[model samples]
Target chain A: MIPVLRAAVNTLVHVPDLVRYGSKPFREGSRPGSFLADLKARLRTFEDAAAYPPHQAFIGNLRPESLADIPSPWYGHPLPGASHQGPFGEILGQGPFYSMLEKADQFGLVSLDAGWTPPANGASAAAKGLMSAGARRGTEKEIRRRIGSGEALALEHEGALIGCIRRDHEEDESLAARVLLENLAAKASGAHALRLLLEKARLPAEEVDYILSCSEEAIGDRYNRGGGNLAKAIGEMAGCPNAAGTDIKAFCAAPVYALVHAAALVQAGVVRNAVVVGGGSLAKLGMKSHRHIEKRMPVLEDVLGGVAFWVGPDDGESPRLNLEMAGRHPSGRPSTPQGMMEALVCEPLARAGRKLREIDKYAVELHNPEVTLPAGAGDVPLTNYRTLAALAVIRGEIGREEIPAFIRDHGMPGFAPTQGHIPAGVPYLGHALAAMRAGTMKSAMVVAKGSLFLGRMTQQADGASIVVES
Target chain B: MDLDNQATIKQLVDAHGAENLVVVLGMSGEGVRIAAETLTTGDPSWAGPLAGVSLGLPVYHILEERVRTRLPAEIYAEKVQLMEMVLDVAQIEDALAGLRKTQAKRS
Candidate 1:
């Protein structure tokens, strides 16, 4: 069996307006020099404390929301205005992370206490300051001179160009995806981040049997371009002859689903190993930051995107794939809070022949409550987990009074960016794996739920679950 | 007869004597029609004497009406024995041999 998720790292990339909470308009001179200076100072303070290496920070000024303004068929909904509050608040809030941690605690889920939070203002000045004093500190004049000369705008945090995000003024989704991947690959030295991940796992290029990637769409000269070719890309990138790709598109649930898929492939002896990787997008970041920036609220500035992952064999002792279950209700059925909870949790557990109290922790839809709870009923993941816990208690699995403690112990408030699949499924994998390895908990469940009505194409609700055990 | 009826006839032949005798081979739609035509025309030079036959929908749906309208009346009236066989490479090889023998006798 593949070992559980060993470690993970993530970064969020966003425009200045998103970082500043819209008080500093995109147009120059909108904010006085003093205000800009103070803003920069606050950003520098937080940047110092963020754990990422200095070279990894990449800044972009152009807002993706502006480019995606025109109505397009590919998007599930009309792109929101630049100032919408919902996406931003949810992506940056600490409440979700707190709630998830609380839930995990309630269920006796053990995770690393070394969790990192993005600065209140998205800035890395503090991190830049930590670099060696001898490193070159180019002034704005030098930076402007380079931009004016039409040279490649090299972004330096302490002093290196780890990655960059460039805008492709193209309408075609597939072509755009290719451009982004190719651009980032070239800048990041042939996608060294992912290559390093494979190397760390001690998985040879030739031995790699499959690729499970979480790209939003698949299509290209690349393997499985549309939906099922992530493995192929990894194979090609890793220089493995047997590598091929497949896609999983459940927004946040994809990585866990991909993990389950890789495990199954190993069990079936189809191939000895597989890799699941996701490339982040700028469009999904700072979605609601524009609104906060406009309202002069604290802009959640950490918008640098990076990928990290899980690698191992199926049926092993380090971390075992203990259980996986999914719950979904077909569209058009009457919305029942009770029924939804049962379908989302109880039914799947029953089918797996497991009871509620037997599992140590249950990680359910742990999205930020500040972003989701204010929207109304059926918006928050924590609510769903609480309801499920209540149902489990009512079903006599535990005492009714234990619901509060159960939630507090079993959940983690959402600390992930609202990058769809990034936060929802895989964010907790790293910490959960570490805990399992330490033998703090025997087993934990990662659950995800998505709203299908937003797409309007289907009336079906979607969910998925996976258990990690030591 | 057109391709659809010819395919049906070929299926029938394979089902019956193909296994019992030996050797089986698949022919193109056009090839089956030509073989059926030679048999229907009472030409002694035609090689194969079919012992059994079956019919199936032609692979191409566009040819259905045309093949259906053109089938010979005598072939339609002939009762074919049906035999279900599991498809495997060895079984297919055996059926082909039977077809060759039938063709040799007819010729």
Candidate 2:
């Protein structure tokens, strides 16, 4: 038998207010007359915690498996019974999130005491559960002066003033306040997700042996532009005293790559329990606001998504990851859709002597259609499924007519936010684990693809896939 | 959006004449409309050789039945079928049709 491991726990965090500071729109929208300038008004169009269905789903308040039965357009149907807290994690608002920024700040950069009063609501009190013990306190006078001098940006929640994030350096554009805030926000959200994994999985922080940060954040100053050690930083913030780790970058596909890496480490006995975590990307927020605003829909990309998964030796009860059957897109292979499907889906199954229909579900890029369609980016996960089905048709595994039914039975409506790596492939792990544990499903495969051209170094596309079996 | 693309299309139209030319676009979403309008009513952005040079050409998206029906069924299935399944065919076709109707009215 191949060395098998289990995904013990996972969590996703939704931080809406961080959009203004970390998103491309707010950064580029500052230019007068830019088309993105309209994003400021569009930011005001974000749905609150209770009213947003996607946010509800992200925090585990609603089961992702329930979306198919809700309606064709899931966003239009609000879950009135949704709450801020969920079995997995919570959807934090700007008020408490500002406090997170202050607490997450390792440097004396973030200050919440200035004009920041805790909201008289239960959400704030609940968010307090996520704060780290190493919080740095700052004076309001420093934040106010920085904002007055254009050195810092004010944090706002529900149109009210809160705290602010300040720049580390005086002159380096790379160390600008907004850029640092994006890094800190990633740290804050990643730390929150790790904490949730420890709490929800009932695993103590000290038990974690290692971590793999797959977030798209490029944390570095001008000297080493893209160099980083976010994994260690997140571990520190989450109180993983014994855990040491590093980042694994492959653009959006990094999460699944990290997943396989962690599983391999555990199987090889290099480490006991390895955690794969990715924080949200701030730059991706409001990426398609122009289309959303044109369609008169809410700015759905407002949320910063973070996800963490704990991988450990199979305990016989947890769903087992088939490490030997993992698929990878080789550099020598063609990058066409068909070619990619062969490498990432077909070849692995062929080697494992499994049929395409054996897999219960396929999770690819799970970007919500509500956020992508208006922006002209088609339903991402649906496209991946169709491509897989089309390949099956060519292989005589299924007839052309069976494509529709195959897609419906084996794929799902994407519920994860368009936060790059967050939706790449791992978001569905929680649901898959649940279904497998309940014996409702047997196995699921996660496929993650990345556009290597985004880095300007290569034109090749990258992809990786892994299967989990009950 | 490229000046070279506009120049190439202008040369092709001038050599073959606009009456014999049909621009088949393989674009998706909002880009389908702009690409079709550029071929029919000239470049909408007014920054290329096609600017104000109304070719009045009939444009069809690759996902449209008009184009798909003309291709060998097997070839279409092998090459374009997967893309057609993934793309928003209805939206792309509607955008092309809307531009074609506008061009018809102008002529």
Which parts of model 2 have CA positions greater than 4 angstroms off? A1-16, A33-47, A71-76, A120-139, B1-24, B43-60, B63-78, B84-105
Q: lDDT by residue for model 1 over A50-130, one digit each (tens)?
A: 322211111111111122233322112322222211111111122121222122121111111222222234222212221
**Cα-based lDDT for every prediction:** 0.43, 0.77
Model 1: residues with Cα > 4 Å off, grouped in runs: A1-193, A217-231, A234-242, A294-297, A304-308, A314-316, A323-340, A368-381, B1-107
State each candidate's chain A TM-score. Answer: 0.61, 0.93
Report the poorest 10 consecutive residues by lDDT, candidate 1 chain A.
Answer: A54-63
RMSD of each: 23.4, 3.5
lDDT, model 1, position A244: 73
Q: lDDT tens string, model 2, A1-470?
A: 23343443333344455555545667555777765545555563323534566666666666665677787555567777667666666565555556666777767777665445655234533346655343454466766787899878876666555567778888877788888888888887888778777877878889999999998888899898768889999998888999999999999889989989998998888988899888878888878876787887666777778888888886878877788789999899878787788899999999999888889899888888888988777778888888988777777889989999989888887888888888887888877777787899889999999999778888899999999888
Best by TM-score: 2
lDDT of 1: 0.43
